[model samples]
Target: EAGVTQSPTHLIKTRGQQVTLRCSPISGHTSVYWYQQALGLGLQFLLWYDEGEERNRGNFPPRFSGRQFPNYSSELNVNALELEDSALYLCASVPTGYSNQPQHFGDGTRLSIL
Candidate 1:
């Protein structure tokens, strides 16, 4: 089974821009989660989507959002991106009906603000 993979590996942007990140979950997984690992943010859960619908979201602003495709792949969208937003975006996954399982992590898409 293929493990999770993230695109762009790294991204750089100025403040007040938009950024999009992608992720592909492992085979047979039905849920995907997004987490932001900023210097002070630690590993904060950004969003969770399952079966093509959003299941949960963290305390982040409305600018942080994402969606899951039918194939279980996912994308994260951030608008009006700020310098503080610069962080490593990680994607995680779990099998359907197994929320208790620790999620497998991607190498993460590093976002930088210039």
Candidate 2:
């Protein structure tokens, strides 16, 4: 069984530039989630999408958004990026409709703001 995978291992951007992170969940998974891990701060949940619909979102602003595709993959988009947004964006997924299922995380995309 393959685990989650993220693309563009690294990204460099300026303070107002937008960035999009992609993720492919393990086969057969239908629930996808996004998270942000800053240098000093630990992981923080960003968004949650299941079966192609957004189920929940973290405390982040509207600029932090994402969507799930028909194939169960997901894309996280951060607009008007700020220096504080520099961090590793991680994507995780789990089998849908199972409350006890554990989420599997992706390698993460490191976004650096200049």
Candidate 3:
């Protein structure tokens, strides 16, 4: 199967700016997750979307939001961007019925705050 794909592989922004990153899940996958990977810190879960609904989210601020499309693709939006938000934003997807299976990740979007 093909892997998940992310667009705009790299982004540069300044504090207070807003950005939107997109993700396309692998064919047949219905759940998508957004994560942040900064230096030193490992991957931190951000948001979860399933079947076009926002199901759950991590301990992030309200500035972070996302939604799943009917076709299963997803998007992650960051508002009031901060320097601390500069990191590799990753998107992963898993088949809805097989929670035990490992999620497949995209190459990730590197967001740099100026």
lDDT of 1 by residue, 1-114 (tens): 789999979999999999999999999889998999999758998999888999999999999988899899999999998888989999998887367888998999999988
Clashing pairs in 1: none
Clashes of each: 0, 0, 0
lDDT of model 2, residue 100: 66
Model 2: how far is 5 from its true place, Å? 0.7
Who is ahead in lDDT, 1 or 3?
Answer: 3
Distance (Å) between predicted and true CA of 114, model 2? 0.5
For model 3, what is the error of residue 72's alpha carbon versus the real structure, in angstroms, after optimal superposition? 0.6
Residue-level lDDT of model 2, residues 23-96, one tens digit each, is 99999999998989998889998998999999889899999888889999999999999999999999999999
Which number leads on lDDT?
3
CA RMSD of all predictions = 1.0, 1.1, 1.1
For residue 45, give model 2's deviation from the true position in Å: 0.6
**Once superposed on the true structure, which residue ranges of model 2 sit more than 4 Å away at CA?**
97-100
lDDT of 1 at 25: 93
The alpha-carbon lDDT assigned to residue 55 of candidate 2 equals 89
